[model samples]
Target: MLFERVESEGLAHYSYIVGDGNEALVIDPRRDCDVYPKMASKEGMRITGVLETHRNEDYVIGSVELSARTGAEIFHADGHLNYRYGEAVEDGMRWKVGRLEVEAISTPGHTLGSMSYLLRDSGGEPWIVFTGDALFAGDLGRVDFMGMDRAEEMAGLLYDSIFDRLLPLGDGVIACPAHGAGSVCAASIADRKWTTLGIERKRNPRLQIESKEEFVEDMAVALEMPPYFKEMERLNLVGAPLLSSLPEPSPLPAREFAIASVEEIVLDTRMELAFGAAAVPGSLSIWLGGVPSFAGWFLPYDKEVLLVDETGDPGEAVRRLRRLGFDSIRGYLAGGMVAWHTAGMESSSIATANVHDLCLRLDRQEKERGWILDVRSGAELQKSGRITGAHQIHLTELPERIGEVPMDRHVYIFCGSGLRAMVAASILKRRGWKDLTVILGGLAGWSSAKCPVVK
Candidate 1:
């Protein structure tokens, strides 16, 4: 038997290709799914089946695209809602991929129709179970997607799905989850790729709760839902258009790029320091690596996106946006910001201040009228205390709460690292807040410098 894990970086999504003889199966594929087919061919196998653990809310599902490319039959859980494509798979239903037997088990928790696939070896002994969002390495999937009213009920279902359905499969069964660390699917999922049921049962904090009531109560904590989730859910239900069907984002020179920028959103995906030094005026600054984690919070789905990528490889930015279901990529700036500056096009820069500078400004609090805005999440603030006088608003909630930020006062944006602060600075710049400065190194640098923090 052959097993390989394909990781979609940034999103922390994991898709697998499992084969036995000449037949293979793909589980929970990402939207850009060319990797699976190539891997199968290299292993001298034909992909005959595609399985979805659940209708994901974070990223577009690639089941239809994979099926279309490999002639594979798509399988997902049978109920809760009607999916436009893929065959509805009922619990206990089995399929053969060479010598391996794939059986679907209803594990409704993360979603009402969530399923886990159990793979049996040639001898009919359980080998590995593909637990979708229902289970992760060190944490269980969040059960709040069905709305707050149904959160507790869903959490209870998740308790049953894990303690009753999945755990009963045996301690030796290896658990391969759909997502790994850094995914929003789980609050604190471990960084490890795969873990056996034995290890999770022994060490997972969620599993320590013996009572279902306690488990549900613990899991009912509300999490910040990204604005893009509803859009992703809507698109995944009907099946998003294939990558081939979308308009290809072209590379535009400075002149054409300026023309496009008048109508489209300019997303500058350069690093924080580079963006702070110089950027296309009015462009939103989300570093290329930070796009996957924060783009969904602020980017409008209806508008086309034009990238200002300094890395010269804008295709990667395109792929990251595509995974978030942002298909309206107009194009990328051909020569990046340098070309625009050389062409005499207007550019903007955000001011940067170090931790010591911030401290000096705070010392003169009575004289200087500036607000230190902490854009890190509430959870982060709780983990690592914030500056004494800093105002708190999560970066995701910044747009809605923009009115609260004082336009007259100088705004010094800070996040866990400088990445999110740069993003906040961009948002403020676009919104016409001129007196803005991003605090470099954020709280990390301040803490290292032994700066006082209010817990």
Candidate 2:
């Protein structure tokens, strides 16, 4: 048996290609799925089937594109909405590819129709279970996406699916999840590449809770849902467009870029710190690493994207955005930020403040009444007290709720760390709001300084 894990870093998504003899099967593929075919070809295997554990909510699914290329049959769990593409898979249904055996188990917690695929060895012994979003290495999937009213019900379903359906398969089975650390799907997932069911069952926090009611209640806790999730769910149900090739972006000179049409958005893919120092006016600063998860929240799906990265590779940034269905990237800044500066293009910057500075401002009551913009999630704030008089607006919602931020007052933005704070500042600066400052260490820094916090 042959198995390979394909990871999409920014999204923290994992897909698998398992094969034996001559046939291969792809599980939970991303939109830019050409790598699977290339890998299969190098191994002298023909792609035969595609399996989706559930309809994804983060990145676009690549099943349609893969099936188009390889004539592979797409199989997904049958429940909830009727997916326009892919055949509905029921519980206990099995598929065979040479000596490799695949069996689907109904596990509806992450989604109403979630399925966990059990891959058995030639001997018919269960080897590994692809748990999808139902279970992760260290954390379980969030149940909030389905809706607040159904949160408890979904959590209960997930608990049963994990405790009754998945764990009973035995401890030795390797547990391969759809996502890992850095993904929005789970809050406390471990950074490890993959883990076994035995390890997760023993060490995972959610698994340790014995009572189903407690597990359901624990899962109902506050969680931040990214704004783009709704769009992804919609596109996944109807089937996402197949990308024959990745979108190629051209490099445009700074002078030409300066007067270029306003239709295109200038995406600064530089590090948050560098972006905070200086960036083109009205440009959105979402570093290359965050393009997949954050760009979709603020960037329009129709407009062309023009990348501005001085440090990271533009090719990679484009690919990450494309994976999330941002296909109309026209090109990148020809000379990057340095060229923009050399050309004397107008640039904007946000000031950074440490916890000490924040305290001083609070002491002095800084003119116009400074407003603290806490961009962290509600759950984080509840766990760790927030600054007094801070208004909470998650970073993902900043674009639509930008007006809620007071323009007359000095705005100090912050998250668990300074990264999200800088992102918030960039959005405000782009919208022509000035007098912005980012609290260097966010709430963590504030506590480190021994500053008083309001719970």
Candidate 3:
């Protein structure tokens, strides 16, 4: 048998391709579906089927794209929402692929139709189980998306799926999850790529909750649903457009870029420091690395995005944005920041304040004293107390709640680390907040400096 795990960086999504003899199957593919077909070919196998454990909310699903590319039949569990593509698979339904036996087991907790596929070798012994959002390496799926009222009910279903149906499959079965750590799907997923049922059953914290009520209570933590989730759900139900390949945006010269439409959203994909030093005026600075986690929070799906990478590749930036369904890219600025500087175009810069300097400013009570904006999530704040007098607002909600922030005072933004603060600073800068600075090292840095935290 042949197996390969294709990881989508930034999003932290995992798709798998497994083959025996000449036939293969792809599980939970991303929008860029070419990798599966290529992997199958290298292993001397032909792609025959695609399976999705659940309708994804974070990124666009690639089942349709994969089916189009390889003539594979797409399979998803039966549910209330009728999918525009793929056959509705049911529990206990079994099929064959080369020297393997594939069976679908009902696991409806993450989503109404969530299913986990069990694979057995030709000898009829269990091999691996593709647990979608139902289970992760070290955490279980969140059930709050349906509605807060039904979250507990959904959690109960997840408990049954994990403890009743999944654990019975035995310890030797490899557990391949749809996502890993860093994905917004689960709060505390393990960093490891994969784990066996034996390991998770023994050591996974969520799995150790013996009673259903206890598991439900433990999964009751707060979660923020990104604005793009509703859009992704609608698109997935109707079947996302089949992408033959990834889009390669054009590079516009700095001069034309300057005169180009002001309505286009400028994404500064350079390093945070370079963005702090100099950036195209009004650009949203979300360095190349921040595109996945934070871009969806700010970027609108309908608007055209123009990138300024300077030292990095904008193509990669575009690819990451596209993964989240932001496809209307206008292009990247050619010649990057240097080109804008040479053209005599105006640039803007955001100041940085070290933790000690910020504390000193607060101590002196400087006239026009700035407010320390805590952009960390509520959960993080609960765990690590906020700085005294700091106003709390999650970075995701900052765009809509900008008015709540006092314009009269200078704003020094900070999160757990400095990355989020920089993103928040860029957002404020574009909206004409002139007296803004990013607190380097953020709250963690302040604590390391022995500054007091407000509990």
What TM-score against the true fold does each predicted structure earn? Answer: 0.96, 0.87, 0.93
Model 3 sits at a Cα RMSD from the real structure of 2.4
lDDT of 3 by residue, 100-195 (tens): 988999998888779999999889999899999998999988888888888888888888899899989999899999999988998889998779
Question: Compared with the true structure, what per-residue lDDT tens digits does model 2 show for residues 132-154?
Answer: 99999899998888689999998
- RMSD of each candidate relative to the true structure: 1.8, 3.2, 2.4
At residue 287, what lDDT does model 3 achieve?
72
Q: Model 1 has how many clashing residue pairs? A: 0
**Between the candidate structures 2 and 3, which one is better when assessed by lDDT?**
3
Better of 1 and 2 by lDDT: 1
The per-prediction tally of clashing pairs is 0, 0, 0
TM-score-based ranking: 1, 3, 2
lDDT of model number 3:
0.84
Q: Which candidate is the best by TM-score?
A: 1
Badly placed stretches (over 4 Å) of model 3 are 220-222, 245-247, 364-369, 382-385, 442-451
Between candidates 1 and 3, name the one with more favorable lDDT: 1
lDDT of each: 0.88, 0.84, 0.84
